[model samples]
Target: MNLKSFPDEHLQSLTSLEYMWISYCPSMDNSFPCGLWPPNLSNLSIGSLKKPISEWGQQNFPTTLVTLILYGENSGAIPFAKADDTRNTATTSSFLLPPSLTYLYISDFMDMESLSMGLQHLTCLEELVIISCPNLKDLPVTLLPSLSRFWVNYCPKLRKKCSRKGKYWPIISQIPDLDILKAGRT
Candidate 1:
């Protein structure tokens, strides 16, 4: 079913839910109820929502959440970084992501200026896919160690710069099992 707006109170009741999909909720701009999400929650998909994920992280983000899918028209611009002077680029909150997370998909992030510093906390991430974001200049260096699959498509600004040398592309190529997916360079 399509969930446009879920009451904040309902978040507490889904303690055993492993997978959650909330999309197209333009007005959802608050933390998900902390008590409802089970620690073992695995798959999570949030799309077209306005709530900053870092706020949700502070309220007890399920450590079991693995495989996160971020989509929607502006959802990718949630700014999952620490709140500090570094905010000049772009930042969210200081929410910590579970170490068990492996796969992350980001789409429609065309307005993000940069990634959040809090991203370094996720040490177990394996796959990262960024698509349709025309403004991403570079990928976070901290995201390289555990990354196995790397995909970037339809990001014109990022691709143009990456096509050259001496920047982040060289570092990206060194990823152990990287699979770069560009617009047509696949």
Candidate 2:
């Protein structure tokens, strides 16, 4: 069922819920309801959310969450880095990813300019796929030691930086498998 607004008490009542998909719910407006995270939820997919994910703190999610998919259409940028005026690049740090998360897929994040350094904390993350995030320019690959598969599609700037001998190359070179596909190339 699809809803424009999800009541907190109703969500809290679904303790047994393991997976949830919310699409076209603009009323959610970027911030999920506080204290409504289902303890057993393992998979969550949100599409067309306007708010950047930086506002979602660690306490807002369930510890059991294992997979997260975020798809934004014309949504604003994701705050992933803090820029240093002296340097041309931004610093990466761990974001509020759930510890049990093993797979993460982000698509069409129009406002993402850089990856958050907080990504390093996803110790169990095995695969990360980013698609159609055109403005994303950097990745903190060194922090994600457990990542086995990395894929990028439709992100021209990021793909170039991850190229062999590129500035970001050495950091991601150790990953077991890497796929950098051009836009619309599948």
Which runs of model 1 end up more than 4 angstroms from their true locations? 1-4, 25-36, 50-60, 82-95, 164-166, 184-186
TM-scores, all candidates, are 0.73, 0.77
Give lDDT tens digits, candidate 2, residues 1-186. Answer: 334455645776789999998766655653553435678899998767544454543234578999988877766555432222122222322135566789998898777887756466677889999999888887766554567989999988888888895776777778898888755421
Question: How far off is model 2, as Cα RMSD?
Answer: 6.3
Task: Name the lDDT of candidate 1.
Answer: 0.63
Backbone clashes per model, in order? 2, 7
Which sections of candidate 2 miss by over 4 Å? 26-31, 50-59, 79-95, 184-186
lDDT of 1 at 139: 65
Best by lDDT: 2
